[model samples]
Target chain A: MAMLFSDPFESLFNLQKALDAFHASGWLEPGPSAGGTYPPLNVFRKDDDAVVIIELPGVKKTDVDIQAKGSTIRISGTRTIEFPQKAGIHRRERIAGRFDRAITIPFEVNVEEVKAEYRDGILALFLPRAEQDKPRSIKLP
Target chain B: MVAPQELAVQPKKELTPKEEKTVPARYYVPNTDIHETDEALTLVMEMPGVEKKNIDVKLENDVLRIEGRIDFSKYEGLDPVYAEYNVGHFSRTFALSNKIDQDRIQADLQDGILTLTLPKAKQALPRQIPIN
Candidate 1:
């Protein structure tokens, strides 16, 4: 089971610092200037596979694009909002626009075995480790 | 109208032992958008990983509350190497005013996005009266 930590604000602060570093290093292209920040993601390793989950609410499955090469994966999508012409805007907090994010895994992955599933606005990816990258245990003499 | 002195006051309900002992769980506030039209108000919220069965919405005493629980127990026993987004509960509250018709409010959830429509009360709607 996933455990909820007591200090989310601190975690978010650290994430912001990491994002800033990524931007300064040119590792990730700055997100769209008009909309909000990039979507939050979780990456974890399950044995010999790397699992990635991204939150993309209000985005259609058809609009999302995923690509993987070597040890890196890229995700790009757009979210659109449509309201009636006569509707009056009250409060607008959710941002809608195009966003792109690329993440690098710690180990080389098998591109052919990559699997992706989108459900409930979450995009989950399973990337299997390359044959040569899997951990091997040696017997002691 | 009955006089205030003649009305009987109801006793306040007591909290059960289980309710008193229960600790409140921490909740993450989901991103939301609010729009208003001539006839109604619309609210859209983002709550990923929440399904229909795990979502709860309650309206009482002019306060609207929404809660969503995401269960990740299915992945138990799997090793975790890196984690960024934490899986947990999502919750938010909204106070409704007299201008809204509480009984006619409607809500729908799709693709992890929740949309709520609060219709304006008849008396609160704008009207154009013709000059006699």
Candidate 2:
């Protein structure tokens, strides 16, 4: 996917990134307009935390904007792709578009203390557990 | 078999390529999720926009190959304003560690996710010894 977005032509990268944003959220019904095959993935979960990893490589931390409120977390942002005028391009695919994905964490999350990290092309999020919601150690008999 | 469209679609300006890693030249991004259960491995792969008529799975030479394609050209003439997810042709291969039985592999694709049940081969299953 990174290969497709390497166009130096500003327009190509700009538009493709826009489309990719839309794709990350997913699209349906095609006719010059299509949805992305890349979905904001939901990873495995443990008792107290539910981890969500989104594959948005070639995107920078500044380009991404995220919000966590109550039990829902919303992500919205853009990954800039450069398109140089001198560079010649034969084909393009990657993606670029405004994408927003909000997940409803099964249990109430600390909302205030969620941790997020972006490395390479993957976004990893750690949703902390509320005090009362987390399991307490039971005394042995 | 490789297709022309597949080649043309993968843009040329590739990454600086940290390592010379190579995935299939032509393959679909199979939506996948792998979770380990107490007894087995559950693999859920999404292959939406693909019909059953054009999908198949084969494990040979210690490689698991899944091949399928979307017949979107049928819907061509339409203007393309945006194309973020363009999956025209697809193929993916995984090298097995020689522990799974090729014959016992079970698969099903429903609601867009292709699930393959790879039970532990006879010699790989765990056994609990009972003490008298």
Candidate 3:
């Protein structure tokens, strides 16, 4: 899951998105706070489970740690980006940071059955709905 | 097929002579086609090699900015054996008009495509009137 950006226009686009990220997290930065890299996340709710995904390019499976509670989940990871040694670097855009994101879910969830998987820089989390949290189908008498 | 122990990730390589320049060149400035209707304005952006996580859409200083980053480097102590596409981040800004309702803008990213739906300001939206 290696991620390196070499485009010239990337800075301009990141500036726009960073503004929105600041509004959501109350801080413009994510990571270890010491050169932390904050990747974006997408959250959605299904009928039986809640799915949360975080983009973590170049991060290895062993590099991430996740914790889940009744209605919240925490993800922590790191991306150490390296560059070519003999390339004679003129511009650098790779980010190195520790990332910790804590999300409070909208509904009660089953924490014991939560699972996470990472592939090709995408982390997928599946948290099943708690027994009482799931909607029931009833037949009228 | 490669085994688990011998998994060989792509290696980082030195840039070609073309890549050794000051600022990378782009074929064109990524732009959006904005079409306004009675209710919403549809914006389609030209963004390739961008993912949902790398993309950002926001309004600041009366400008609509679109941002994205791409990660494609493979490994250390190795050099790329082949190459095709170049990876880079993208940024583009558009001037927001009085006709737009900034607060209600909705964006969706799918398969590297970013579609933003911005509903018009009520006063700026078109209305129908009947002449009796």
- In terms of DockQ, the best-performing candidate is 1
Per-residue CA lDDT of candidate 3, range A22-121, in tens?
A: 3344211222323222445544344456666555555667878898887777777765544433322332333445676666666687888898976645
Candidate numbers sorted by DockQ from highest down = 1, 2, 3
DockQ of each: 0.20, 0.02, 0.02
Higher-scoring candidate on DockQ, 2 or 3:
2
Indicate the residue-level lDDT of A57 in model 2. 43
First chain of candidate 3, TM-score? 0.67
RMSD of each: 13.5, 21.8, 21.7
lDDT of 1 by residue, A29-74 (tens): 3333323236666565576787777778788899899989887787
Report the C-alpha lDDT of model 2 over A18-131, residue by residue, as the tens digit. Answer: 434544342222212222323344343444565665555445667788888877777766644444444333324444345555555656789788999765345667777787
The CAPRI class of candidate 2 is incorrect
| Clash count per candidate | 0, 21, 12
Candidate 1 ranges beyond 4 A from true positions: A1-37, B1-25
Which one is best on lDDT? 1
What TM-score between 0 and 1 does chain B of candidate 1 receive? Answer: 0.73
- Candidate 1 chain B has its poorest 10 consecutive residues by lDDT at B6-15
Residue-level lDDT tens digits of model 3 in B32-103: 455555676666554544667877888877677776655433211122211222234556667766477888
Instruction: Give each model's whole-structure lDDT.
Output: 0.68, 0.51, 0.54
Please state the Cα-based DockQ of model 2 relative to the true two-chain complex. Answer: 0.02
Q: Which residue pairs clash in candidate 1?
A: none
